[model samples]
Target: MKVIRAAVDEMWSVMGQMTSAVFRHGLPMTDKIAARTALTNFVLHIHPVRVRRSWIRMSYTLCLGGLSFFLFIVLTVTGLYLMFYYVPSTQHAYQDMRDLQFVVTFGGLIRNMHRWAAHAMVITVWLHMARVFLTGAYKKPREFNWGIGTLLLLITLLLSFTGYLLPWDQLSIWAVTVGTNMAKYAPIAGPYTRYLMLGGTAVGDATLLRFYVMHVVGLPLVGFLLMVVHFWRVRKDGFSGGL
Candidate 1:
């Protein structure tokens, strides 16, 4: 029992060191260990190393950016749950949606959560951008982050548009037709871009597969990478509240 107690204490000591290395708090500025840990810690990197009082004020930041990220997490979890039962083929997609709504336990709830969360994320991201613009947070050093944010907004819209067709219903079909048609108004590459998106002259199996891959894989990966850089820039630029 004495040996066991000693081992357990040693284990706890190691655990405490691990925790402190990643989450240093109240350490002196001269502490090299804390500074080194801060540089490499993923959690610490998400936030500024030195925080200003105005940065934390609810009235200043308004938490819209945080809410948008939370909604994204919700959509990812619910989307994974949905992907298990959904088949992207035009023949199966609508029927699969029907089964999820009626046959699968709690599937409808999860699907609704995903749908509404997507909508909410769009709203929150827009509001977050608007707030930044209103606060003059997009000037100077933040201009690059603003450009990234604009790309993120376009990505969000494309995600929504691509996902609309997954239901494989008349409404979705007609909606995409109208949307893709508008792309033809672009300059020289407009028609080619529409053709590439459709994968043919019309929406069919190839179009469904292409949209499915993009909605599930391509766009999300790009969006996530952008978000990482976006957060990193926010920390590096010092949150804009100082101005």
Candidate 2:
């Protein structure tokens, strides 16, 4: 379509501009022969050769945000595959879960990978936040990015909480019950919060549906938007520190 072509062309123009900027800064790039040689010799040939060693080290450690993003991609892939076999209902949910674990081919592996990736994302994001905090990366110019990161942390927690109910077992039931009960103590918004979350006074079909939608649709959408804001803010804030 014309729209698709226009979008692609626009993307190409932006990438071309970025490439020009990088080369104009005197970052290393060579002719075809040297490029091939570097590719053959180096472990990560994609990285610019002119970067300072200190920058490389800092990027690896502090860029756990990037790792968190990678894990999120993994989660999304595995989650999609798992969703093909999952039934987000009280009646068929537990059976589908058992089938995933014991019957479906590679289903258990996919589910396990998604679970572990989710946990890793949460841990990495928290560690990334801690690193930023200790480095005073949240100061002044970076405060908005810091706020975005905080929202991402909340989204991660919400993702985990929403996922806990998918198994549709006693554990899921009671865990959600206890979690929503805590929401009932949120000052003036507590009662309304629980009502909106559960769709009723009790955790049943409606509750599962709400949580499922939140996990698969609502929260991921917010996470993605916030992630864009976070990344753009980082670039705008000038890469955090001097190399």
Candidate 3:
């Protein structure tokens, strides 16, 4: 019996040491411990460890910004799934869409989710800006973060617009045509901007490839860097509690 007890105690001693080495801190049952845990955690460091209960009411912030970020994540995942099969050529693009919808497992569902989530993100981002404006959250030290948010909103719209051409259908072409036409009204840089975007006088193979690269690689990279900065600034500036 003593021998068995000794073995059990030895096992528990090893377990305790292993847990401490892995976790660094045990359960955060107290405020001090919780703060310590938050400081040590990568994800937790992005948010303040403490805030008054009254400061975080749903009506105050509307949670729109967070929802928009969540939708972006959903779009990224579904977009990646679709990217495996999508071709950015005038020839195979529409046929690939058909195959994705009819042949691949969950492809149609993921596509629909990506589509709707994108639309939802646009709405949420706009509403988030509106909420911030209404609450006067952009008045002081938060102006920089607000600017970042604005840029993110623009990037979101561009991402959605660029993705509109991937299907390479009549509606897709028409939509992109109408959207790009608006750029021609921008004064001195209008025509040049549009030409640069299309890579020619009109939307063709070059336009399709350019849009694909921007939609998948270029804009996303810029947006992701801005997002990291935005989140970091939010952590620094603290939440703009309601007036």
User: How displaced is residue 202 in candidate 2, in Å?
Assistant: 1.5
Best by TM-score: 3
Candidate rank order under TM-score: 3, 1, 2
Model 3: CA > 4 A from native: 1-22
Query: Can you give the lDDT of residue 201 in candidate 1?
Result: 79
Worst 10 residues of 3 by lDDT: 46-55
lDDT of 3 by residue, 1-243 (tens): 999999999999999999898788789898999999998888788778888765688888778888988898898899999999999999899999999899999989998998899899999999999998888998789999999999999999999999999889898888988888889889999999989989988888899999999999999899999999998998788788766
In model 2, the runs with Cα more than 4 Å from the true position are: 1-53, 58-62
lDDT string for model 1 (1-243, tens) is 999999999999999999887666645466566666576677666665556688778887789999988888898899999999999998899999999999998999999998999999899999999989999999989999999999989989888889988989999888999999998889999999999999987888888898989998999999999999998898777678743
Q: Which whole-number lDDT from 0 to 100 does residue 132 have in model 1?
A: 93
Task: Give the clashing pairs for model 2.
Answer: none
Worst 10 residues of 2 by lDDT: 42-51
- lDDT against the true structure, per candidate, is 0.88, 0.84, 0.90
Clash pairs (backbone) in predicted model 3: none
Ranking by lDDT: 3, 1, 2
The C-alpha RMSD in Å for every predicted model, in order, reads 3.8, 9.5, 2.6
lDDT digits (tens) for residues 1-243 of candidate 2: 999999999999999899866443333365554554455544334334344456447554567887998998898899999889998888899999999999999999999998899899989999999988877878989988999999999999999899989989899989999999998998899999999999899889899999999999999999999998887776667555543
